[model samples]
Every structure is written in structure tokens, then in C-alpha cells.
Target: MNRLFDKSIVLACCIAAALGLAVDARLVAAFCLGVVVASLAEIAQGERARRASEAASYAYIMVAVFAPSFAPFAPLALYDIARRVRREHVWGALGAGAIFVCALVAYAHAGALPARALLLTAILSVAATLLSLRTAQLEREQERMRRTRDELQERALVLEARNRDLADRQDYEVELATLAERARIAREIHDNVGHQLTRASLQAEALRVVHADEPGVAADFTDVKRTVDEALQLVRASVHALNDNATDLSVQLERIVEDARSDGGPQIELEVLAEHAPANIANCFAAILREALSNTMRHTRAQNVIVRCMEHPSFYQLVVSDDGTGAAKTNSRGIAEGMGLGSMRERVEALGGTFTAGPRAGAPGWRVFATVPKQQGDDAR
Candidate 1:
């Protein structure tokens, strides 16, 4: 923009120089010459506004450039130049000539020397003013263009930042899930294969003691066979869980609750605010509720549990409350607890949703609220 304005201002001054040095009629003709360039520029732009306006602009510019000696018309001509043409050759020529004509008239009447001096001073003053206005306009336009470019650049930066933030958050979620799955795998190894191997080792030692002499290997073989069989069952169960994520959220929650009960972990009373929900949302709610209840059993002493799963067309809400005790009494999300409900909160939040857990209002228990985005829930489903 600055370059464009500079070039235009220089062009204006060059045209003005030709006019000041020329004879009067020729000065007018030279100032009017830019009509050809303006018309061609308008044609190249294919801008109807410029093309439609060519005639009026040309007339105004020509008048502004040549009307000085034709004065009282000069100022009107300048105004018309700005209004009709917006810009043209007249500002320098006519403006300079007006002053030159007056100064020359006065010097000659008063009998001052050679007409040359008056013409030089008057022409210089007009030339200086025209170039001055041109430069000022250029500066203002440059600043405006700079501001617009900066604004567009700022918007692009903001979008890129948001995109990066979303991608980082997604990567973090995938990492967390892998870690959780690995931990479950470790637990499986401990519970199934580890125990079986230990039992087999013990039985082998017993067989070693009992049959110090004959076919002792038979007993050890029997124990090894039994342990391997049990290990196979455990492996199959883990595979089933991995493949069957299509189960409804409520069913998963019930399974978790029943498992906790069987383990004699904790007694929890669960309630559903909706009998059936959109199957998609129903899953995360189920997970969130299950995790909340798991934390209640593992971490809290409060007994009574009430889980409300609310459904709507566009969104869903879950409130898992446990009378086990308050947050003030125990931490649901401390590093000491490692990967439990805190991890659950992180999981829910990653789905572009909200998860809040704290002490229940007016109740001495912890309340867990998890709301997953409907859009993400649909994808999950």
C-alpha cells in the first residue's frame, strides 16, 4: 500500500512539473493527459464503479489542473476534484497557476523586474502544497492498510493456536487410555497367570516331597496342566472385554457394581433418572458412573449411593453421589490415589465435555458430575 501511494504521489508531481514549465494551454493539456492512464487502469480493474465514473472524474481532474487563472473557479474546481474524480492532475497545476498569475500581475503592475521571479516563487509554492497533500494521504493510507493486514494475521494465529491445543489434548487422552489398559493388563497377569504359576510351583514341590522315588513327574505334570488351563480362561475373558464395548452404559455400571459387591468391596445403592437414554451418551455416562462408584468403594467410607443419569435430546448429565464421606474427609483426585476417579475426570474432559467432583452440597458425601458432549458421544456410539 505504501509503495502504491508513493508511486502515485511521484506520478502526480511529475505531471505537475510538466504543467508549471509549459505555456498556459499546453499546461492544461499536459495536466489532462492522465485521463488516458486513469481510463486504462479502470479498464484493467474491470471495476464498474470506476468505469461508470470515468467521465465525471476526467472532467473534474482537468478542471482542477487548469482553472487557476480561471479562478474564483479554482477552489470549486479542487473541491470537485475530490468529490467527482477523488484525485487527478489539477491540484498541482491550477493551484500553482492561481498564485503565479496573481503574483505576476502584481509585480508587473508595480513595475518589478522580469516576470520570471514571480512565476518561479508561485509555481514552487503550489508544487510544494500538492506534493505535501499527496504524501500525507499516502501515510494515512499506509497506516490503515498495515492495521488491516495485522488484524488478519492475528486471526490466523489464534486459529492455529486453538488447533494445536485441541491436538495436544487429544494426544494426551490416547496416551492416558493406553496407560490404563496396560495397568489392567498388569492386574490380569497378577490375578490369573501369576497365581496359577505360584500354585503349580507349590504343587510341584509337594509332589517332589511325596514321590521321592517313583513316577513323581506325573503329579507335577498334572499341576502344570491345571495352571495353564486356568491361564487360558483368564486370557479369553480379557479378549471378550476388549471386543464388547457396545454394551449399554447402564449394563456396564451394573456389572461393575455387582463385581464390587462380589468382592465385598462396598455396598452401593444406584438409581437411574432415565430408564433408557440415547445409546451413545449412555456409554460414557455408564463409564463415568462406574468410575465414580469405584472410587466411592475404594476411597470413601460413606455408604449410601445414588446415581442419577439424566438424558436430553442434545445433551446428557450424570450425578453420582455417595454418602460415604465428603471431599473434606478424603481426596478423590490426589496423586497418592494414582489412576482412579482423577483419571476418570481426565477421560471425560478429553471428550470435549465437563466433569466435576466435589463434596455434595449440604450433604456429607462426594458428588461426581460428568457431562459429555453429544457430538463426541455420537462418535463414540
Candidate 2:
């Protein structure tokens, strides 16, 4: 709506005015001359914007200045009047008013040529100033929108960061509980299944020794031996299943690492120091490994990784490190501080243990050392 009443629109109406005024070809010539001159001024300014307004404003001003006393077209006069509503263009109307006044005064007793010149010049200057004000307002609105867009983008980034942090913390808690449960299951299997199998094997051996002394009991001894063999097979299969399940912890750790790495792929090295570690200790260490690996991949620029498992009398310790820049070198979350030191401590303490994760004392990378106690459940007593 605003654009429709711009200086260019006024200029078009002025052309019709010039035609209707029965003004000589010279006046039409004057309108075209003003257009070319204003366009060159706009070009010389090197702004490229508001060309239509510039041309029209100058043309309209010329007609307005010359029209009142010289019989300007009614439509062109109305166009200029409409432009006064534009806040910046109010001044253009003022200038046109001044010129129109002067023209009326001068033409009353002055030569036609001088009267036309003074009236048009005043009107032209007024139009140009008003158009410039409109252009300024539009630019201000555009700048305001741009600022709003930038601020929204910044806020979105902050929200995304907080969301990611919460997700990582939730994952850490879930993995800790999983490790504890696996340890409990392991204890149940070893204390019950393994003990019963050892007792059956011992009984079968004793029966065989008796069979050697009594031929009549030889068949009974053979059956006892066969039963022992079947029991042994079942025990072996159970152990194998436990071993298969053991690998699941490692797989889960790798998945966490992958999430941390996101775009980059993480390479993990897992080491087990105690092959017969208590289920609780082993599973806890596996969870720690996963968390450390995730931090390294997500935050560090380094690539290579090493996980070391150390055995103790009543506890197991795992130290996960990477060849990357380590925690101290970078301020942003590096391997040692990726999930945050507080979360790491919680994981170890949750299992009645202690954990320390940080740069390896002056070493090139970071390390996480978690020590969890060994406990027996239903069968230990």
C-alpha cells in the first residue's frame, strides 16, 4: 500500500498531467529531463535502491511546482496530495507548498519562465528529502528483523546443548544399574550352578572306586559315571553362555562411544585384567569403559584409545585413556570431563566404589580409574 503512493507513482501521474495541461512539448521535455537527472544522481550515489521513488519524486515536484498557476492535471495534483500521508513525505508536501506559493506570487507579476523555474525547484527538493526518509524507515525495519533472527538462532543452540547434556546423564545412570544387575546374575550362577556340578563330579569319582571292589555294583557305577558326564556337559554349556553374555558389556560400551563421537567414528581397546573377576566388578568396569570411551570420542581431537584393567584383592579397577588432547589441554569437555567429573564419581559411588577421571598426570591423554568392591549375594554365606 505504501509503495503504491511512492514518488514513482506520483511521477507517472505527473506525466499524464503534463499531457493534459496542453503544455508545450517543452514541459513534457522538462519532465523527462528531470527523470534522467534524478536517475543519474541515484546512480552516482551508488545505492541502486529507490530509483523509482527518486525519478518520480523529482518529476512530481516539477509538475507540482509548475502546475497550480499553469493548469497542472487534476490527477497529478491528487497524486502529490496522497503522498503527503507518508510520514517522511510530509516534508515533500511542505516544499511543494512553498513552491506553489512562490509560483502563485511570482506568476502574478513575473515572466512565465522564471515563475515556472522557481516553483518546480522547491517542489523537487521537497520530494527527494521525503523519499529518502521512507527509504530510511524501511532499512530500519529490515535490520530489526535480521537482529531478531540472529538472537533466535543463538537461543536454539543453547537449548540444544542443555538437552544433550541431560541425555548423557540419563544414559550414565542406566548403564550403571545394568552393570550391577549383571554382577548379581553372575554371582547366582557361580555360587549355585558351579558348586552343584563340582559336588556331582566328586560323587561319581567315589562310586567308581567302590565298583572296583564289588563286581555286582559295576553297572550301578557305570550309570553314575554317565550321569556325571551329562552334568559336566550342562556345566560347560552354562559357562559358555556366561562367556557369551560377558561380551554384551563390551558391545554396550562401544555403542555409547559411537554416540559421543557422532560424526567421527571411535576406535576402542578393551582390556580385562582378571578373567575371573566378580560379576559386579567386571560389569561395573565395563560401564566405566563405555562412559570414558564416549567422552573421549565426543570431546577430544585425538584418535587412538587404550583401556587397562587392573586387579586388586577385593576390588577391580579400570583405567580408560585416549591418545587425544586429554582433559587438561582443552576447556570444552574432553575425554576425562566429557560426561562431567561429577557424573563419573556418581557411577563409581553408586556401586560402593571410587572413581577418578582426568588427564594422566602430565601424559598426553586422559584416564578414568574406577574401583568397585567385590560382593557375594545368596550363596556366599
**Most lDDT-accurate candidate:** 2
Candidate 1's displacement at residue 133, Å, is: 99
| Tens-digit per-residue lDDT, 1-381, candidate 1 | 433443355445444433434357734553444444333433444566555454443454444434333221222223223322335655654554454456446655674423453354345435544544665676678889999999999999999999998896677456546645755775776677767666766666667666756665766666666666576566655544443333345555555565566444555666555544545455567667667776777677765777677666666678888777545456444542466666767767766678877777896778888887677765663
Error of 2 at 104 (Å): 8.2
TM-score of each predicted structure versus truth: 0.32, 0.43
Which stretches of model 1 miss by more than 4 angstroms? 1-246, 262-267, 273-283, 326-328, 331-333, 336-338
Q: Which lDDT values do the candidates have, in the order given? A: 0.56, 0.58
Q: Give each model's clash number.
A: 4, 1
Instruction: Give per-residue lDDT, candidate 2, residue 337.
Output: 55
Cα deviation of 164 in candidate 2 (Å)? Answer: 7.1
What number of backbone clashes does candidate 1 have, counting pairs of residues 3 or more apart or in separate chains? 4
- Give the clashing residue pairs of candidate 1, or none: 64-90, 65-90, 302-323, 302-324
